[model samples]
Target: MINRNNWRLVKDYIKYRAEIDQVSAKTLRLEETWLEHTLNWLGEKSIDQAPRIRPVFSDFVLSESENKYSSEYLRKLVSAHRRFMEWVSINKEGYRHKITPAWLKTIKLPRQPEEEREHEFVSYDEIIQIARTPIKSLRDQRIQAAAVLWFLSGIRIGAFVTLPIKAVNLDLLEIYQFPSLGVKTKLGKSATTDLLLIPELIELVKRWDQLVRSKLPDTSYWFAPLSPETGTFDRSIKAVGENRTSRAYKDLKELLDRSGLPFHSPHKFRHGYAVFGIKNFTTLAQLKALSQNLMHSNISITDGIYGMLSNGDKKKLLSSFSPATSSAPTDLNQKLDEILSLLKQNTPIKSE
Candidate 1:
């Protein structure tokens, strides 16, 4: 029987599988959770011995894939285990067949469709109100500004949390989102975005940047986490090592409660950015260009996510058919206008 001591092998693999594989941060945590469940099931069986209970593993994998776990989650576990077995064989001889990669080929995943939730729009007034309110402390105000900038700029949270102060150019009213700095961008295409257009937000970001730079080197990260150590020096963006967005989300909810505003997370703001830009500033061609700035593949992706018509907008469309509606073209007016124009041309009418 596999005792707790033998289970250490599974735990060891779980710890390093993601880092060794160069997986995403979210992916690493998930694999660790799944491995914990699988090891519990194999309480007494050794790694090499466990898969002889191949039937048991198979049933558990399938059930987990179909039930508690989604298809995405199931696929990740299978991948993690396959890599774990490969690691075991190279480091600790004679466990090569434990993974039996063939079983992974037969595993089916629970595929979820693209998320269809509508993007929540934050109004200009709401932004101004939040800016005016007191945030209890300077740190809270910094978090609020970060949240606002995420919505205002359509920048990714991953890039947002790690942005260095040197990357910002407030004098030019621009932010070097990608190519200008070490900040990672999708496809690595970087462009500078104007920040001066939003004066209030510019003031907030300037204050935050000044506060951060006074404490850190110009090369230091803009968003650093709270340190538990007394008098420990703060680290660079990469050194902080944890996502600032999760805590930002929690703090934002509390801010909303005090402000009496409805809550919407940072991602929905991204969706709002796409839809809002389309609705206001431009035509379809212009919209495609804006969507490109947002790094979307096609205008259709922008339209699909942002252009679902609202009930109020639909009501306006339906109201346009009424006789009193000034927008409606009248048949009598069209005929009269045509006749008057013909008379002005001095055209003679022939009797049949």
Candidate 2:
């Protein structure tokens, strides 16, 4: 059994790396859970006992796989183990090269399922329903606003929760996701994105923005806290910080139920933005603009991650590339016209 002191040392090392990596608090918390599960399973087993522990580790991974853990999840567990052991091999005395003989060489991660990989993004109609759903309560109104904002701005729920009222400029149709301003952006990234171009989406955001400002200071969350007692925004409440993200999810599910629509998380809105935006973009410049608006580092990252087309859409698109028909099979003039038309617009003529 690995001693308690050794476990503490491992934990400290993980913490040290987390700080250096600037991992989000939520992700760090999950990594801690994964590490704890692993170390507990290897209880009291010194790093040098890797050879004897190989079978045990393998069994543990097999059990998790059988229990329906996702390929992504299993991969994360393996990554945790690899990172921990690498530290152990380097820092622990007499543990040199020990990780190489351990189960790392034997473990193979499972492939991710296709259904999970190519999930459909939410549709514009769905967001309209979510936004227009009739509800009498202020809390319900807030939920509707949340849904519309997700569709319009593609804001991640984490950052949404932390947004202060002033962070959004409804008149300018801009959102400032500044972490130093307490927006809780991933990797503390700071950027701005324009709101959705649809007038309805803009109006929905405008209404909520005005309502929140009326009730609280500019620094209060745009999605203000709901008073548990009255089930509405507490105008008198002075406390400032993010509301629980889980509660926002619950509200979304409740809204979906009321609208008789399928439940999709706020993050899926981002996917919707990518899929729908790319589909209609008439030029390469427009595509690149959308990618930048979504805060992707490069156009390829945007395409690789969110540019998935449904099977039906793919077929329809390919059919458009087929040769044009003419009145007679030997109509050379018509055939040349069709070919020339296709060739003219084959590339985007829009200025970069």
Candidate 3:
């Protein structure tokens, strides 16, 4: 059981995060859940007691590990506790000296397992297969279009589901992810994203866009909710609710099942977009453009997430490499040197 003082402190910390840090409600809820677990584990001990009792913290972590909790779960718990401790140190004069920076450094989970680090993404062929699958209803068609758009644009599911019809410009191949326009972009980030130039997929997305635009107003969600009675779009619905992503997820899962394709979460489409761009776009400029399209802050982030090539791709690429010779550097070598220089600088290379 948590002591009343500890509980009150936790609530105060959460409120600070909400009002001062301005974190999303979803993030606050997650932090609260993780902090609750920490408090429960601490039992009669207060938050300040956690750092002093290093062995007790290790034991708690051991217990959670035995329960097969993921490294991510442990990481979040560590973050939540660290934030609470920092808040306590600053806000509560009594605990100021207890929670030191060196003590805070002790609050860390073990390194993640190698298997957990392996990346899994939807393949290009898989997206094409899903797109080509026959649709039995208008909802099915919309889901297909959404899936294709996700692959082409790599917008997060949150933004995709909350995207309004007005934000998507098919003619310019641009998607304006503005929070002010009600697009729920991650961290409230706004960017103008470009669609991949796949004509067949572009046409498919356009067809759905045209249909929705003709029926619903610009303010309405492009992936509009269906009316239960009419079995058509609910025109009265202007904005998507919080449960929008869950409903969209379920619909996508059903469509994947019907199409006889294995289900990959909406996020996998984002990985697919990155992988496709990396494989197809050879120039450093093109790679930078691809990173920008994915809305990543830097190319290093993009490379870190989607850089690994499959075993077969690696084998093929290695086999195709030219034999080393004591000659002047080739164009490929010069390009690689330039890429290395730019990567070291950690800057975006502009396309010519």
What's model 1's TM-score?
0.59
Q: Write the per-residue lDDT of candidate 2 for residues 133-209, one digit (tens) a residue.
A: 88878888888888888888878888888888889998888999998778888777899988778898778778888
Give all candidates' CA lDDT scores: 0.62, 0.75, 0.83
lDDT of 1 by residue, 278-327 (tens): 55653334554555557665555656766555555557767766667453
Which candidate comes out best when scored by lDDT?
3
RMSD of each: 12.3, 6.1, 2.4
* Poorest stretch of ten by lDDT in candidate 3: 110-119
By TM-score, the best candidate is 3
Ten contiguous residues with the weakest lDDT in model 1: 343-352
Instruction: Rank the models by TM-score, top first.
Output: 3, 2, 1
lDDT of 3 by residue, 1-352 (tens): 6778888988998999999999988889898998886777677887667676645554577576786776667777877877787888888878877788788777777665644344667778888888899998898898899999999999999999888999999999999999999898988888999999999899999999999999988988888889868879997776678788888788899989987887889998888899889989977888888887887766788989876766767789888776664335687687778788877775767666
Give TM per candidate.
0.59, 0.83, 0.91
Better candidate by TM-score, 1 or 2: 2
